[model samples]
Target chain A: MRSLSVPSSPVRDLLALTSRPEVISFAGGLPAPELFDLDGLRAAADRALTRRTLQYAPTEGDADLREQVAARLTARGLPTRPDELLITTGSQQALTLVVTALLEPGSVVAVEEPTYLAALQCFHLAGARVVAVPGDERGIDPVALAEVVERDRPELLYLVPTFANPTGRTLDAERRAEVLRVAERSGLRVLEDDPYSELRYRGDAVPALAASSDLVLHLGTFSKIGAPGLRVGWLRAPEELMPALVVTKQAADLHTSAFDQAVVADYLRESDLDAHVRRLCATYRERRDALVGALAAVLPEGAVRTDPDGGMFVWVRLPGEVDAAVVLRRALERDVAFVPGASFYAGEPDRATMRLSFTTGAPEVIREGVRRLGEVL
Target chain B: MRSLSVPSSPVRDLLALTSRPEVISFAGGLPAPELFDLDGLRAAADRALTRRTLQYAPTEGDADLREQVAARLTARGLPTRPDELLITTGSQQALTLVVTALLEPGSVVAVEEPTYLAALQCFHLAGARVVAVPGDERGIDPVALAEVVERDRPELLYLVPTFANPTGRTLDAERRAEVLRVAERSGLRVLEDDPYSELRYRGDAVPALAASSDLVLHLGTFSKIGAPGLRVGWLRAPEELMPALVVTKQAADLHTSAFDQAVVADYLRESDLDAHVRRLCATYRERRDALVGALAAVLPEGAVRTDPDGGMFVWVRLPGEVDAAVVLRRALERDVAFVPGASFYAGEPDRATMRLSFTTGAPEVIREGVRRLGEVL
Candidate 1:
């Protein structure tokens, strides 16, 4: 049980090889460093470096930061009050807090078949019984979700409804409504992890599940748009759940760093975050096209990949019985790398699957990395 | 079980009253804001504002920061290596991680009576059985601890051996050895939470419990000396524990903020933390003296408080059956505040006990606040 908590995935082992500067790795879901607004953050730091910024803050979070996030979330179609939000180290921590607050040991949790790996780790740590709801192009299949919910009596249904990690698939608006209905009928709560919504390149934005349902615990992060290193994120939870979440959060880290929260709030007030996100979307859109176009041009005839409209990843399925780990090994020999999709799944893995991330590289660089991958294939 | 996790302590209730501008609050264990090295930190932040500072870092923590912490711990008597430590949000999170890594649900954890409130909260969150080992002013009694270990067979013995929070009592050198012997006899691991050793205002330092026992998981933090707002701390553990600790920490917050870690590293590198600590110690000494002297002169005959040599708090036992909450209400009316000590205990209430913090208020302000308490008495 102890060792199982630590990931020994072939993908993680292979990722170690991609650290060489020569490897134009499409492995990590890291945001483009060139896009981080250093000047704006520096100015924010200047404004935030007060005595109050160095003291212990309220357990809930910095009031002004919550207000800023509340305003932004409200502007984004989800009406949120400051008190309704809990600022976290990152949305990752927000997920951990939710799992801790809502689930008891051995409680059932239903997640997408191939969900975020770290979320799986959180559920694992909590001793949760995780059942995967099968899905296809439009994210979690509502029929399967309802079946899983009714059979397992899952306390929570976790989703990445928009541009999800690993998959880069947004649940279609129709499916989102169906999923909510399934949840409502089964009395299952949904955790909407929305880290990639703002990174959309081409698709029109869908209203978040939380926009229609208070039962949804909506999670968001500055890691994608602001800066990952700052490690600032938040969860907008139903008021009924706030007390337990607060208690769990307090037990977790007291609160997110006061200095980071203050700086983020100041940056939001002073800088053009919308413009910065627009620039990011523009660049990522190009990179996404480059990876998609390159994969289409190079891979074997039976090989298939998702041409995601937005977000970091492009999920791929290789020709019959082809192991992604074997492909990863060959790619690394050529100084190229990507994660084996098997690592992302909660249930039995499809050994033929792999994920390619596009956000870290320039379009040309991503094309070249895929070009090397084609040699391996 | 859910509501039990949320603290509804009368002290927390009364603390709201002390937030008014007129009140002089020693209710929180906050570091002195005036003492924060703003210029040094600003310079550090200036040096730390690289693209990497805003990018996601290794889950274990930044390499440079761990090395700096390793060096500091080595210099302070306990030999440490960078690899042996895991960087955390604060020692608070360190406690949480240790609990997650070591204890299972219903695992027995023996803590010093009137332990830090948040530590109890973490144990409660994990569903651990917490038993308090009774002690006097010299901290946890080794014989009583041995009895608890023999009878309860607690998997862990948690202590803040050096200048503990709330109590501010340092376990004497003799007792430290006895406790180590007790731990060895029982095969029980000790978590020495030593956040305040550097803030010592008087007396020669005792070697940390970690210095004598490899079984000790030593927790230290920058919150008191550097700044709480940064939320930086570390835990030094045995090699066997690192894998589980790292995994738990990764799931906790994806490592503490990368920017905060880098800035703290740069600050530690460029600045003389020892000299800053010395300056802090000097000032806190006077404040400690003022609170102690004032209490001696004015408190009614049966009232007693520890004359702590170091740390943030001074634990007091008011005259028999005089509820600390009742005293707090009267003191709040006088615009003064302290935490009622019953809140810190896990086993049973000590209605006559309370904790007064000397770190937050200046000597003159502390004396004035104590004078107001005298009026209420």
Candidate 2:
């Protein structure tokens, strides 16, 4: 018998090393736990623990939760209906479900060069061939995307277009339209994963790619805004794909946790999610500023980093010949950590790059973490 | 692009029809909602709603919950370590993880003739070729299992040994040993699904197959005893398989809900689960007797039925020339429902068979539902 043969994650292994309490680590993609609404969530759980909430729910999702999600998406400029969405364990499960519904083994998929590592792993587990579409400071390079699409004939193109993970790059309106045009011309489908859109600290929200094209599948998660421990997310797809996705979801796990879904729905109804998000943005923005300012002052003259408008990460490109992995080893010796960017690639390695997450620490703590990294460098 | 090609479940679709308030459905495999420990669970949730429980946790699972699950399994006769277990989203997700970890596309798997339908769908979704091993009254026939393994050269054997779905037959101790012997000789892996073992109303407990063989992967769930809405389950596997299973679990949904896991752990610590289960057994046993007795008094002469010692369902075979599906249509018209047993078979279906669940109603209500079913027949 043969197995799926997924490679052990280097990033996850590295994160484990940084988990020691003594280490000031920027290696994890986790939300700040201090920001969670404990009392609000506890109240929601109290109200939601009823006979209806304790029963097996529909495979699509809890209808009230779906309606709540749909309404929020519509308010954000993406017109959605409850029927168009399928609740998932997290947006991570949404990626797996999408792959199950849309791609087969050996089918070609295009992903951004250094995309979300978990998404790359999902595609590989499904036995799909991944082709990388190079990106620039402005996010995915439309010309490069077109070239890759023409060459590889990929069935699906995966993007994290709004305040993306690891890189924290947002595609401008013009760039998003150009990417969609390329996909449309090539008859390709796009999966727009927008988990960090609502985490924006400064910029106005951009319309989702799904709002403009029926071919795009949209994914959103409450992990960043509500709580990751709930494991709740949703996928919005075109009408044609829902049947297969629902069937695949039922086979995958029957459904996501009904009690969690009910609690989330009640929380949305009885609490101020917008106010909660604003508080998160206020704290995270300060942390981000601290990390970026500290990095600029310490790094060598040739080094460059993306100063994102929002999101959790600041992607840094070290000076020429300065390998990030080597730096990470030395940094670990000083109880400081960041992820070497090579682990996020779907194609060629970039050894002189790294990703730092600023969400888990305060401004002072983040500055302290970067100070330790500065000494290692 | 190609989808996984899993067919929509006929049973799930049939269940949607049975959901009307007027219908008395023995079609669902749902635990009684009133039996849930609402207050106890709410208290647990209140305590578990902490910063730790609201953040991303280890993909392997919460260490505390694993320790508790391990201790319970150890007390029940299977010696286990916390590290040997992986928490999943219900045991349903456990089936998907096992399929991903062990079976590649086109690998052969052996299952009982009329097995858990969802398991069949999961195997098929992974492109595995499933072959059915016929069973008699005492669960899977060891002789038939040996012949199928020898002929088909299946890599794995799946059995719901104690109080199985569709047919609540339990494997006797002698038959369990024989099945393990055949598996050992053939170098076959066995998946011992024991979801309903804790709900026993009569008979002595049988040792899990994992107790006797390291090759057996044991699956258990809190769905039956606690609540399915929590979607908490665990799988115990050999050390050789744990790495792949952990990796697969990470790729599946990062991990099961940390909030739910923490609540379940706290509930187990703070509440008396044995007493709750005993209460469930007492009620369900009376309902089972009522359903069985009613069927015996009403079914046509020559019809045969299984009087299960414990668990949710009782399988029935009507007299000659009967079609269970046709009877279901007539029964539904009278606001009474059951699952036609043909949907459970992996091989040829028996048109005369049907499955009735007794856990959803009181004894008087169960008798009334069966009386309506009698009129339709």
Q: Could you give candidate 2's per-residue lDDT for residues B200-318 as a string of tens digits?
A: 88889999999999889999998999999999999999988888888888888999999999999998888999889899999998989999999998899999898988889999999
Which candidate number has the best DockQ? 2
Cα lDDT tens digits, model 2, A167-221, are: 9999999999999999899889999999999888787888899999998999999
What is the Å distance of residue B190 in model 1 from its true position?
0.2
Give the local distance difference test score of model 1.
Answer: 0.89
- Candidate 1 wrong stretches, greater than 4 Å: A1-5, A8-15, B1-5, B8-15
Interface RMSD of 1: 2.3
Q: On residues B81-114, what C-alpha lDDT tens digit does candidate 1 reach at each position? A: 9999999998889999999888888899999998
Candidate 2, TM-score vs. the true structure? 0.99
Estimate the TM-score for candidate 1.
0.98
Provide the overall lDDT of each model, using Cα atoms, as 2-decimal numbers. 0.89, 0.91
Candidate 1 lDDT over A71-172, as tens digits, reads 999999889999999999999999999998888778999999898888888998888999999889998999998888778899898998888878888899
